[model samples]
Target: MSDPDLLAKLFQGDPRSIARSITKVESGSEGAAELMKAVFPRTGNAIVIGITGAPGAGKSSLVDKLALYYKDQGEKVGIVCIDPSSPFSGGAILGDRIRMATLGMDKNVFIRSMATRGNLGGLSRATVDAVSILDAAGFDKVIVETVGVGQDEVEIVKTADVSVVVLVPGMGDDIQAIKAGIMEIGDVFVINKADREGVIRTQKELEALLGLAHRPDMWMPPIVRTVATESKGIEDLSAAITSYFDFQKAETGALKFWSDALGLENVHTEIVEDQKVRVAMLPIGESRIELLEPTSEDSPISKFLEKRGGGIHHIAVEVDDITASLAKLKSQGMRLIDEEPRIGAEGCLVAFVHPAATNGVLLELVQTND
Candidate 1:
C-alpha cells in the first residue's frame, strides 16, 4: 500500500507528491488503488477539457498554448497527451518529455503522455485514472489531447467536461467535421493556423454545419480562429471554453444529465472491480486432463488413442525462440498445429506442440518473439 501520509499530502495540494502519485498510477503500481481511494473525494473539482482532431492539425501546439494561457490566468493545469502507438513497435512517438517541453518545467503544470496501448478509446483506461488523480490533486483544469479524429478519439470526448474539436485551414475537406461526427461532441471548434488561406471559407462552412445541428440545450458551439504557433486568438479560444462552461451551468437539465451519466460510469467501474475479484478467487486448477477408454466408441479421444495409441501426448512448453525452436522441432519429426507462429494474449508467439511427441499430453508452446 502507498503511504497514506503521502497520498494525504497529494490531496492537500502538494505538487511534488501529486507528480509522484501520477507516476505510480500511470505505471500501474501496486498501491495506486489505495492512493485513488484516498483522492477520489477531492476530485470533481477540476474542469476536464478534451482536445481532439485529425492528424497534422497542430493539436499539440494548441494544447501547449492553451495550457500556458490557463497558467497565465493563475490556474494550475494538468495535461494528458494521447499518442498513437506505432504498429510495428507498439510504442508511442510523441513521448511526454518531448511534447510538453515548455510546460514540463513549471511546478504548477503536470504533463503525461499516454499510448493507445490497443485500448478501444484512443485514450487508455489509465488516462481516465490519471485525470482523476490530477483533478484530486487540485489542478483547476485538466486537458487531454488526442492524436486523431477516429472512433477512439470520439470516445475520449465522452469523458471530458468540455470537448474541443480543432481543424486547420486548407485541409480541402470542409465536410470533414460531419464525416468525423465532430459537430456532435464539440463544445468549441478551433480553426487552428487561421492565418493560412481559405480560413474564411472553412469558418463559413463550419457555421453552416453548426446551423443544421440543433442541440437539445439550445447551445450553439462557437467556432474560434487561432494561429496557435504565434499564440494569437488563444484568449478568444479560452473565452469560448469559459462560455461553454457557463452555458452548461445555466442549463440545469443538461447539467443534471451530464452528472447522472458520470454517476453511472462510477457505478459501472465498481461492478467491474467486484467481478474481477470474484473471478480471481475462484478455485480452478491450472491444467486439466481427460481420459478415454478404448471400449467407448463414441469418444473422440478413442479414435486418437487407437491411431497414436500410447505414442505421445501434446507437450506444452514456453520457449524464447518460437520460429527457430519450431523449425528444430519439425526437423526432429514433430508435427505442428500451425505452420507459422501467431500472437497470443500472454505477450508471446504461440504454437501447438505435436501430440505425438509428448505421450498423449496435448502441448501448447508459448514463446516471446519480441
Candidate 2:
C-alpha cells in the first residue's frame, strides 16, 4: 500500500498498520524518514510520561498499573517499553507485552516493546520515532518505561514532557539517583512497593533531597506512593499527573526559545487604533508574523486578516546584500513584489519576492542592521 493509505490506517488506529509502521521505523527502512515527517505535526498532543529507575525497581509493574489507570479514564493509551538488548541477539530482553498481558489485549491500548539496540541513553532514535507514531495515532497518553539509572536512561527520560522517577524502600536508590543526576530530571517521584517496611523513610529521604535542589520552573515535585501489585495508589499517581498538566497550562511566563531551535531578538507591543499588535522577533533565519488592525478597511494586510484570521504573513531568508540578491533574481527573470529594500520591524532591511515567483510562497529576503 502507498504511504498515504498506510498513514490513514495508522491514524484510524489499525493495530496491524501501527505495528507495521513502528517496525519499519525501528528497522531504519528506506521511507521511514518521510513517514516520521508526516507524523511529527500530529504529535505534541499526547502526554508523554517517562518512567525510569534502577534495575529491579519494579518500573514495569508501575507502568502497567499506571497505564491501566489512564485506560480506565476512557483514554486511549500507548505504552513503549525500552528493554535492554542482548549482546548476542540485539533484541529486547524482557518482552513488555508478556508482563502487560491484560493491557496488551485491550483494543484501546497499544503496547510496543523496543530494544535499546546498544544506543546511547538506552533510547534509540527509533524509540522516539515509535512514540511520535503513537502520538499521531491518537493515543491520549504515551508511557515510556525504561530500566536502569544509567546516563542513557536519564537521557531517554529527559525527552519526556513529564519525567517520573521510581524508587523503592531500602535500596539506597537515593544515593544512586543523585549520582546519576536523576534528582534534577524527575517531575514526579514515586515510591513503588509502598507497602514495604520503610516506605515513610524513603519518602522522607526523597523530600530531604528535593529540598536541596531548586528548580528553575519552581515546581515542587510530588512524591507518590504506589503498591503496583495490589493496584494501590494508582489513583494518586494518575491525579498527580493531571495536577502537573494543569499547573503547566496555568503557567504564563516568558516565552522560552531553545538554543537549538530558535533565538529571540526583540519583543514589541503596538496599538494600531483599537486592536493590539505584538511583534515578537522569532529570528529563525528570517521568517516573521505581522498582525494589523487598520483604521481603514483597505489596509495592506487586510487580505490576510480576512483569510484564516491571521498567521505567518511571509517567509524570509537572511541575505548579505538584499539589492545584489534581488538583482541576481531579476537577472534570472524572476517576478518581484518590491524591487527596492524597505524598513521592517526592529529596523530590518527587507524586500519581498512575489508569491507567484516562489510557487505560491511569499518569500522575503532580509538584511540585519544590527
Alpha-carbon lDDT, every model:
0.70, 0.74
What is candidate 1's lDDT per residue for 11-103, written digit by digit as tens?
Answer: 776767876787777677888788778778888999999998776687878888899999998999998877544232124434555655666
lDDT of 2 by residue, 14-73 (tens): 877899899888778899989998889888889989988766677777887888888888
Model 1 poorest ten-residue lDDT run: 274-283
For lDDT, the strongest prediction is 2
lDDT of 2 at 278: 29
TM-score, predicted candidate 2 vs. hidden true structure: 0.66
Per-model root-mean-square deviation over C-alphas: 20.4, 12.9
The TM-scores, one per candidate, come to: 0.62, 0.66
Please report, as a residue range, the 10-residue window in candidate 2 with the lowest summed lDDT.
251-260
